[model samples]
Target: MTLEGWIVIGVIFLCLVFLVGTTISIDLVLFAGLAVVFILGIIPAEQALSGFSNEGMLTVAALYIVAAGLKETGAIHYIVKRVMGNARTVKKAQLRIMSPVMVMSAFLNNTPIVASFIPALERWSRISNIPVSKILIPLSYAAILGGTCTLIGTSTNLIINGLMIEEASIRSLGIFEPALVGIPCAIAGFIYLFIFGDKLLPVRGSSMDTFQDPREYTIEMIVAEGNTLSGKTIEDAGLRNLPGLFLIEIQRNERAIPAPGPYEKLREDDRLIFTGIVDSIIDLQQISGLKPATNQVFKLNAPRNERMMIEAVVSRSNPLTGRTIKEGNFRDRYDAVVLAVSRSGERIDQKIGDITLKSGDVLLLEAHPNFVQKYRNSSDFFLVSSIEDSSPVTYDKAWIAGLSLIAMVVLAATGILSMLQAAIVAGFLLLVTKSFQYSSALESVDWRVLIAIASALGLGSALQYTGAAEYLAVNLLEFAGDNPTMALASTYLATWLLTEMITNNAAAVLVFPIALSLSQSLGLNFIPFAMIMIVAASSSFSTPIGYQTNLMVYGPGGYRFTDFIKIGLPLNLIVATIAVSLVPYFWNF
Candidate 1:
């Protein structure tokens, strides 16, 4: 291997470290590495930025707008309402969630599909008395499996097809060609998750579980002087049965009542201390006379309805990391009031102003809508996310949005227009028809994912331009000389391994050239080999990092890395087996 090959290997190793070892954004890590290699003259400048203009990348960006249209118009909400019907059992519930997501994911991008479903699943779990932990992982896996059933199912498929058109001799793939192998894989993967997933899945405590977070937040809610609750007994005040929250005590003037009995009478200006999940704070906010302990909230400019509730994970680089909330003047500094703080399954139990902030601490905040837009990209936060249904939806335009999505699929699937062309028209219709606002559409695109995909493409290009990919492919294929099926299996295995370690689109980009080179080396049709790479690359079930949907579910599902390993390992093998076995049959040499 040349020095360039060694450099590519070293750069990829560093990327893995940045992705796994730290909380840095994946986009920054990938772009930073791409810049390093480009500066060192390992790859040309044009190739480094080529992904920015790649058809696959742009199509992904366009599709995000379409997904946003569906969400903004309440089309997603309506669909979830109708489909998630009276799910009485876990299996039935999983089916309800998985079936819709699978079908939607085949036409829509899986990222937004999973995002739209999350809130629905949460709402359903609460209503059905089912643990959300059992449902979220399967939701992600279903999207992944369903994506394999069509060309437009995932960005990775378009990426592989785009690469084939530019680098290989074969014509572009038809919309459903991969389905020959993909449909089988999807069915097999779905069955495995449906049957064995619940058993392998851990029953993690919900966010409100006392055992999960021991240091319960001590929130002081002061009753108004003239409110109806002022003269009522503790039980008569209607304070009990606050889901996931408990009224621990009451404070009146100089007296402290510990664990007040149900009949204990309440008085004006009585202070109530509740210990529970941060999410339940909204319930307290709704109580007519119960104002939060802090007056700082009264100073915020926005009205309650116009503002939003957000959760941000403090990053190491945040300037507020070492300071107390009081010392930092967090409310004034960020125009947001800290409602609660949680750290590693433990809620912080102290006066909101006195607690010190730390990296990885989750802070629940009540802030203006602009707070998210202002600090979403700040380095101080590893993640800044708004809670689901936090923003108002345009219910009237929902059918328009739904119909627009259908049009995009029908046009692209029928080859009346390319996926890219159809997506552009659909995205334009969304904006023009007021189904999605332009400003909102721009925000809806996961630019970080796009940047990461582009950067990974650059890195993949570096391998090809430096001759490293061909060098590696030739040496790797020598062992599977005579048998094409052996070669096919070997190709699937390599691509699958790469996908598990890196972003799926990048994995496909990096492995495509190798798949092509091996095809030529064996004098076999490149189509079957390309199909194997596509399916193998998109089937990223073994690790959370392998797919975006998995990562999105990790925190919400209360999942550990090993949780994915336990469930996803077998499913990964299931899809790999079906894909590898069926590829040669459909596109035989």
Candidate 2:
């Protein structure tokens, strides 16, 4: 091997060491490696910065906006509500979550699907009395397994396809081409999780379960007319088991039912009273069919979607302390309407308008985002703070967002437009429909992931340009002793090991040139090798660092590092075996 080839190999080895041993961000680490290669003059400037203009990376960026649109419009939340029905056991809950998520991930991006489900599953765990640790891993793994089924499912697949187009000069893969092997692997994975998930997964409690807040506020919410919750029972409506909240009573047509049963059905305009901590109250506020009982929420100056939830404590020196909320005209004075009140860790049962203000009373208010900044230092309240992720959802535009996504998928699958073009069109549709603000679309893109992918692509280009990949491929073929099956297995093993150590997309990019070189040396078709790369690159189940989704669930699930090795290692072997055996059969060597 030449001096430049050896240098490239050494730089990549150091990159793996840092990625595995340190706490540095993946993007920064990979970018540093790319910079080193560029500085050494191993590759030209165009090759070094080529990844930023790659179609796959830009498609991933555009897809983030599309996912943001779905989230802002509450479309994903609506689907989760309908599919996550009652589950009596851990296995049933896993089933309920994994089935839809797997199908959804086959077409949509995997990261957003896991992101949307994490909080929902956390709440569901509290309600169902199931430890969150058992459900979160399955949520992430399901998305990963499903992403292997389609071209647009995960960024790794898209990156590989892009490399094929630009480097191998081959046609882009069909949308459903990977499904030939991916479906079998997904089915096998589902079966494994269903049968062994309960015994293999841990039972640790989540952060929400261990923490107890003393302050409880009694809040009243009404079932909107012609809403989904009107005819459903309390249990069916998902109101029976809020972790920190209790359904105290129901008021319908001047009649009160105390301690409503789980089987009790709700009617239109029925006012339900609940006493809970602030966290659970925030969850309740986001439910689509429920509205605050007080009409003041609707009378606020700012639009509902632009408002935020704020907690403020009343001071003794405040002028309105001696008067009831209605008598003092609180909304007119503060430009915020009080939704719930808690005093000395006790629930205030009086109606919101009838509750008399008291010193040190903590009020939950619905107001504009500027409310906190405007009164942070004022004597009107002791402290003012806005809750994170408390902005109201725009449920009215959900259909528009859903249809835009469907149109993008149809256009791409039908070959009417390239994946990048389709994603951009979908994002534009979302912006013009006002489903979410443009600022939100920009915020939704994970810039770090994009940077990591682009930098990794540059490193791959360095390997190919310096002849390092071909040298490595020659050694790999020598190890396989001229056997194509063994060569395929060797490539899959190397890619899988790399994925478990680094980011999946980075692993795929760094290994791609070598696989391409291996295919060329063997005088065989590259299709099978490409298929194996997709499967191997995505099979990142043995560790949290290997995949973004795995790391996402780590803290929430309260998982140890070995927790993944214990349960995920076996699944990784299962997927690897299925991919190696099926790829040659489907695509031929």
Please name the candidate that would achieve the greatest TM-score relative to the true structure. Answer: 2
- Model 2 C-alpha lDDT per residue in residues 1-589, reported as the tens digit of each score: 8999888878977886776567666678779998999998988999899878876667767877887787778886777667777785899889999999899889876765675566556655665668999999999999999999999888789889999999999889998999999999999999999999999998887436644767888899999988989899999888998778899999999999999999999999999999988878877886789999999988888877668799999998889998999999999999999999998878676899999999999999999888999999999899999986576774889999889877887887676888689888989998997888887788777687678767766777777678776566456545655678887887887778767644567667877877777778888888888898899888888876567677667766877666788889999889989988999998887
Q: What stretches of model 2 exceed 4 Å from their correct place?
A: 1-58, 88-90, 104-137, 147-180, 196-212, 442-470, 494-534, 543-568, 582-589
lDDT of 1 by residue, 1-589 (tens): 7899789878977887666566676678878999999999888879888878877667767877877777666676557656775566778878888887888788776765675566556544553456788899989999988898889898789888988898785799998887888888888877888898778988873434523534345567788767667777766554665556778878888678988888888888887888766545544554445677777777787654445678898999988999999999998889998877778766455678898999998887878767788889999899898864344342557788888877877787676887678888988998887665576778777787678767776777777677666566556656667789888887887777667655577667777877787778889999988899888888878766667677667655767666777888888888878877788788878
Best by lDDT: 2
Question: lDDT, candidate 2, residue 358?
Answer: 93
- Superposing all C-alpha atoms, what RMSD in Å does each candidate have to the true structure? 11.2, 4.3
The whole-model C-alpha lDDT of candidate 1 against the native structure comes to 0.75
Residue 215 CA displacement from its true place in model 1, Å: 16
Question: Model 1: which ten-residue window has the lowest total lDDT?
Answer: 207-216
Where does candidate 1 stray beyond 4 Å? 17-25, 52-55, 88-91, 103-137, 150-180, 199-389, 416-428, 433-447, 498-531, 543-566, 582-589
Each model's lDDT comes to: 0.75, 0.82
